[model samples]
Target chain A: MPHRTEDIEIGLLLEALYQRYHYDFRHYARASIKRRLLQARSHFNMSSVTALQERVLHDPEMLPRLLGFLTVQVSEMFRDPSYFRALREQVLPHLRTYPSLKVWIAGCSAGEELYSMAILFREEGLLDRTLFYATDINPEALKAAEAGIYPMDRLRKFTENHQKSGGKSSLSDYYTADYGRAVFDKSLRNNVVFSDHSLVTDAVFAEMQLISCRNVMIYFDRGLQDRAVGLFKDSLTRHGFLGVGSKESLRFSRHASAFSEFVPEEKIYRKREP
Target chain B: MSAPPDRAVVIGASAGGVQALLALLPSLPADFPWPVLVVLHVPADRSNVLAGLFEAKCSLEVKEAEDKETVRPGVVYFAPSDYHLLIEENGDLALSSDEAINYSRPSIDVLFESAADAYGERLVGIILTGANNDGAAGLAAVAAAGGVALVQDPAAAYARTMPQAARQACNAALVLSLERIADYLKGLKAE
Candidate 1:
């Protein structure tokens, strides 16, 4: 089939973005990319994607603005309580045997999932022994994650989810609310590192015992999903754990055989020892 | 009016969707030609049984749309609850948990607009019984892309707001009764 006009324009745009900005969305699922690009076009007051591409090529400042559109930033603390509960009950027991641990929260948007894991580790008495790596392609989100502050209004739902995840103490214990912002204790960040990492272009930086890369691959095309899962396979220690979103699965991934279902209902998989 | 040839059907419903789906889907024969994709409003927290329920009633194979799965003819694919279903240019399915649009995660507009891009004139967008106006703008996108737009007649719908909204937004190619819509779908296979 011949490429649509918009499709051609988008192809060039993504190529230009990669060449100049080095942010690769070329292999992302096409429909969502098109949708987000169209949104970016309208937001920037451009008539067509071609015009937007021209501006993006010439103006470096437009990169972050467009990245804001391309990356999905919506997330919540302990978004799925059951997944965390399963982590605490099912996966934590296995990790307890390890003298020290590293947890990689891939695609850790705005620090919500990272904070959830951090709080969980602290509650389980594993925080001191654990090194947390929270990473994403979005620098803005990384900055936000490093800040560890959220608007006060979101605390109610966060508290409920934390409680549901078998939280050992009040959610309030981790944060102090003042002037409509909840500043999570700096102690939570003592062992955590926030960094800019692209699953598409970047390789495994460290071997990890637990990698929670939830909901990020839904935006990726099959080849890209395979690449990320392959990285996970390479990055995991022997019998390490991997958990994805409720709806995500390793069944279709090319690397499926590398992991077995640990908490099947929660989409959690464990690396199989050779 | 006949469905456009080589077209796919994208249907969206919210309140009273199950009854509407049952009334329409079960009537099609075993070898329905065009693939049917549906997005019914469901809570994020619960497991969706939409495919399972439809499988018992419809002769067509029913399953939830998986990420990057190619669109297959004669299959009925339900948008899994809490995910936006999109059709790629290559006619594969892609799922997104991006923020909800128009207060809906599986927003009819998202699916319809994306399908319009993929199928163009070879698409049929349908709005069924629902209490919300989620499908109106989506049906309009289908129409704008030279695809057919359909809506259940408000008076005949169990919940009319959705169809009424579609009527107000787009000049639908057909305002069909549930039985007529089923008959129309069946007629496509004859061609």
Candidate 2:
């Protein structure tokens, strides 16, 4: 099939972005990328994607604004309660056997999932021995994740999700409600590190006992998904756990041979002993 | 006359959609040549059993759309709950959990707009019973892209607001009852 003019322009834009700023979005699923670029185009008051790309290539400030559109930032605490329940009931027992633990929350948007995991660990009596890494490519999201605050309106759902995930203590134990914001307990951050990382371009940062990277790889193309899965395979210890979003699967990944479904319905996989 | 061989069918519905779909989807035969994509509003926490509900009744195969998967003819692909389904430039399916549009994750507008872009003139967009106006602008988009737009007659719909709103937004090519819509599809297959 011949490339449409707009598509060729998008290719050039992604190429320019990679060569100029080192953010590789070339392998993102094209449909979402096109939608986001169109959004960036309108937000910047540009007539077309080509104009937005030209502006972004020259204006350093445009990169961050466009990054907000290019990357998805939707997340909520314990977004899928069943998956958390599976983690708490099925995965935690095995994790408890480890003398120490390193947990990686890749694409940890706005710290919701990180705090969710931290609170879960605290309730499970594993917080003290666990080190957590919460990483994302969005600096604004990273800053928000570091702040650990969310609107009070969202807490009701979060609290309900926590209870459903088998919370041993009250959701109130993890945060104090301010005027309209819920400020998560700083103690939860004691063993946590927030960093900028990209699954698209960055290499594995550390060995992980459990890696939860949900709703991130759906935006990637097949080859990119394979690359991210390969990175996870390389980053995990033997028998280490990997949990993905409910809709994701390792069954089709090129690196599928290296892992087995640990919780099939929950989309959790465990690395095979090598 | 038969619809073009390259034509793709995109359908969107909300409240009372499952029943509406039951009345419409079972009519298409196993050898239907056009791929059908559906977006129905579902609760975020609920699992999508749309495929399961239709698989036994419909002649065409029904399954939840997967990320970046190629679409096949004679199949009915329902958007996975909590993910926005899109038609990619390469005529494949893509899913996203991006922030909701019109208070919906598997938004009708998102699917219809992308399908319009991908299929262009070779698209058939239909709106059925729904309470909200999520698919209104999207149906307009389909019409703007030179695709055929159809709507359920408001009097016959389980909920009238969606089709009424779409009627207000665009000049739909046909506004017919569920049975008539099924007959129209069967005619396309026969052609």
Please state the CAPRI-style docking class of candidate 1: medium
The alpha-carbon lDDT assigned to residue A230 of candidate 2 equals 95
Q: What is the TM-score of chain B alone in each candidate?
A: 0.94, 0.93
Error of 1 at A130 (Å): 0.4
Give candidate 2 regions above 4 Å deviation.
B1-6, B189-191
DockQ of 1: 0.71
Residue A208 shift from truth in candidate 2, angstroms: 0.8
lDDT of each: 0.90, 0.89
Q: List the residue pairs that clash in candidate 2.
A: none
Best candidate, lDDT-wise? 1
Candidate 2 DockQ score? Answer: 0.71
Tens digit of per-residue lDDT, candidate 2, span A1-274? 3566878888999999999999999999888898889878887799877898889999999898899899867888988988999999999999999999999999998999999999999999999999999999989889889999999999999999998888889988888989999999999999999999999988988999999999999999989999999999999998999999898888778999999999999999999988
